[model samples]
Target: MKKYTLLLLTIAATVVILIQSILYIKAGASAGKTSGVPAESLARLSEQVSVRAARRGNPWINLRDGRDLVAELTGADQGLLAGEGLAEPMALASDDFDEDGTPDLVTAHRAAQGGVLSFYRGNVDAVYPNAPEAKARKAAGSYTDAPFLSPGRLLATAEPPDLLGAGDFDADGHRDIVAAARGGSSIYVLSGDGRGGFPRSKQIQLPGRVTALTAGEINRADGLADIIVGISTQDGARALVFEDLRGAIKAAPESHALPATATDFALGDFVDGYETDLAIASGSQLLVLHGRDRRSAKQSRPRITSRRFSSAIESLATGNFTGSHRFEVGVLSEEGEIAALTPVKVKSKN
Candidate 1:
């Protein structure tokens, strides 16, 4: 009887150990896998809720649900101040076109057929930014005294574009507007008159529909501003560089194809003194293409390096977040988390 009891006790102990082992394996599988750049190589500074909902611009200014929000960034602290009673905006772009030192604002709203572009000339005034009055006047459509004076809507499009970008594409000292049609292959350029007017729009055709669009000096030697557009192709999403060729009606742009595919992208000089690098959101990864200086030799395609983020990135924005003069990328995750990511020096040779 004693021998049989001892054998039963040993079997019970073995069963308990087996159960614990299985539970441990199950927990490990449920945790998921962590991949991408190591913590020492890339740092996530902060997660902001406001940034996740922002449509365009950096922390200083951004558009949220047709409302314009302004914030003051002081060191590590940031506060958002939103304007009320403004007309509903679908897209926003800003630049100092008139050389007034203050950046001007441009907004696009949905029209019946397509979209309507509006320009707001920037003016600096001590009393113009009064919080209560600006909001009230904006509702009445007579906020001329406010910081952004509306010159009224400038141009209309045949099909409403999903994205808006501004740059001096012609090198004519005024920023022109680039609009990418939603789920369409054509991109439209409306030349800015430097006085808040766009008389006409020129169409540039692409092979595939545009997914994301941004304006930057992709080719510094060209002297004319260029645009980087993420387009959907037969295989997958691809990035294309469209060089602004001055003066050609319905011209086929001198385009360069980048190797990386992206759902959203932003241009910035990630490494100082190098050509502009691309921060791309493709799949669930963030790719950084360290641009090659094409001026010296044959311009080869930029090499892509990637970091798999915890969550899929929905949108990307670039800004000088660290005061390091180098621009960092702000990624809005699909899970509604916003993280500011900057690359750090790698220590391990591997």
Candidate 2:
């Protein structure tokens, strides 16, 4: 009986070891596959797959089958902005304005019309009627007829306003406009007024030139939108949080100084299970500023996660990529190299 029991115990231990060996082999294979491919190539391929799938009106597709494989343009000259006539497009925003399931594209032109913010309602249809051959196309003409708030008198001056953001700032259903003028160092809050047109409201002045601005619901509430403004000066760039109270901007407690030269900021859920955090792009680096707990008397500074990049980052946007939350930092250099960063894995997890 003792010999039989020993045999059974040995077999069970062998089975456990076999299972672990199989898991390690599977994990190593996945790591090898990912490591063999360059990050840039992976990013490009992922984008191509997404675009191709999107054009087919089916964003969700099984990667294993690969039946819907289609050739995609990975070059910068690809007609992503065909018929848009957008010169030096610096900033891009995506939102579902029409309550449609898909989001629309809004591009901010840096040169044309002296720096106008052009809103293009992205058509989900694979073939845009205007550009039947192209997958994506921009709407015609200026959505906002007036000149963007800047120092110059040009109807569409692009002096690079201190800040620009789009959200329901005034608690209205429609997305209102919010811009900070570089010359005046003031924040202009526009109210939707429950109508289609936005009426300009009071302009609040800040200490320095606004470099970046973003809107998000940080407190997990729904009444008004929260504004995150990055101010750049000779000293350094600092981020300020303001509560949008029906067109009036009030400073929030999260307003604090940061280390780098903040250029453009974005709000999104960085940590999978935690609340949204502010991601700031400073020069060629991206920094993640986690929200602070107000209850802590020790006064812990905002947690900063820095990631280096090859090119100078001009702007940033945070959204879900491959079902995991990620950030797409836009680089505005002559070299068209755009990259997205995902969470790095630890060796202990393996």
Candidate 3:
């Protein structure tokens, strides 16, 4: 008899929880309808909930309130390399530098001669035995001979580059190195010779000090990749698009003034379009410049949208960060918190 009473109480409590949940949802719906909450706000709230559910299984980040910022923590506590004589690491970039189907890492450190680039090769075979590169290389009997640090090679720059980026800037088959000099108005494009060497570097002068650097096909008609740089002048912050013409950069770049001083920026397909857009972070505000399609007029400016955050953003990164088909923007806060922002769906005016 006592056991039966305890079981009844457990079921009763479960029923009460379900009842309260339904009531709470209904009350929220009623309040939303009566309190004149904007449809966009409701849509954002619904999307936040969806984002949380989608990211709940991710082991790296703790997406507590979906869109809210939280400090990111990793399981490992040890460093990758130690006592390598690297001083004051400034920027880092990564890509498959060798075309060996393994992603490599490049870190820039402050050096006496400007910035030093450290190349760390990726070991796909050792790390992932079943990876495509591993299988193909094994089948062909072509194994990597050396470890990550390619024995006697060192890359250095003339100026201390605050921002580092990788892309085929000259439309060459091999990817090249791109860096923006800190506190200076010069952008360097170091051409990769495809055999683990940078043969030459081209310097492009900008209007002001470079704050950020990124590469994309901003002007699709050119059939080449262009470099977009964020600059800060006495007037304000601005974005410049330097068109790549037949493996050479244009002397005069097209510039657009930003609303605020950009701390960092990235280029990605953030909105519902095939064209790449720009995401800029200025203090606590996030501004997006929507890219124009091929059919649009060339002289028209991009449509910009601004969103304010509670904390100041330190930097901006572009990727499929939210596990969505379209690329989203991930921001790092001054307090070391991380958050993601995706394109929000809105009703068409037509």
Flag clash pairs in model 1: none
lDDT by residue (1-350, candidate 3, tens digit) is 99999999999999999986665454333222213323222211122342435466588665544442111112121121223554567887776666655566676767555766666555444444554444554455443322232222346677876788886777777777788776789999888776556789999888798877776666344455667788889899898876645553643576778766678877777777767777778778787777776456246766777777788888887777767666678889888988787773323211
Top candidate when judged by lDDT against the true structure? 3
The list of candidate 2 runs beyond 4 A from truth reads: 1-163, 172-174, 181-184, 219-223, 244-248, 252-254, 292-300, 322-338, 344-350
Please report, in order, the local distance difference test score of every candidate based on alpha carbons. Answer: 0.59, 0.49, 0.64
| Candidate 2 displacement at residue 67 in angstroms | 30
Model 2: residue 149 alpha-carbon error in angstroms: 24
lDDT of 1 by residue, 32-111 (tens): 11112132322112233434446566766776433232212121111110233222356888886554445777666555
Ranking by TM-score: 3, 1, 2
TM-score per prediction, in order, is 0.63, 0.51, 0.65
Candidate 1 off by > 4 Å:
1-88, 98-101, 126-145, 219-223, 244-261, 294-298, 322-326, 344-350
Q: Stretches of candidate 3 above 4 Å error?
A: 1-86, 127-149, 219-224, 245-248, 294-297, 319-326, 335-338, 344-350
* Global Cα lDDT for candidate 3: 0.64
Counting only residues 3 or more apart in sequence or on different chains, how many pairs clash (N, Cα, C under 3 Å) in candidate 2? 5
lDDT of prediction 1 = 0.59
Write down the worst ten-residue block by lDDT for model 3.
69-78
Evaluation by lDDT, superior candidate among 1 and 3: 3
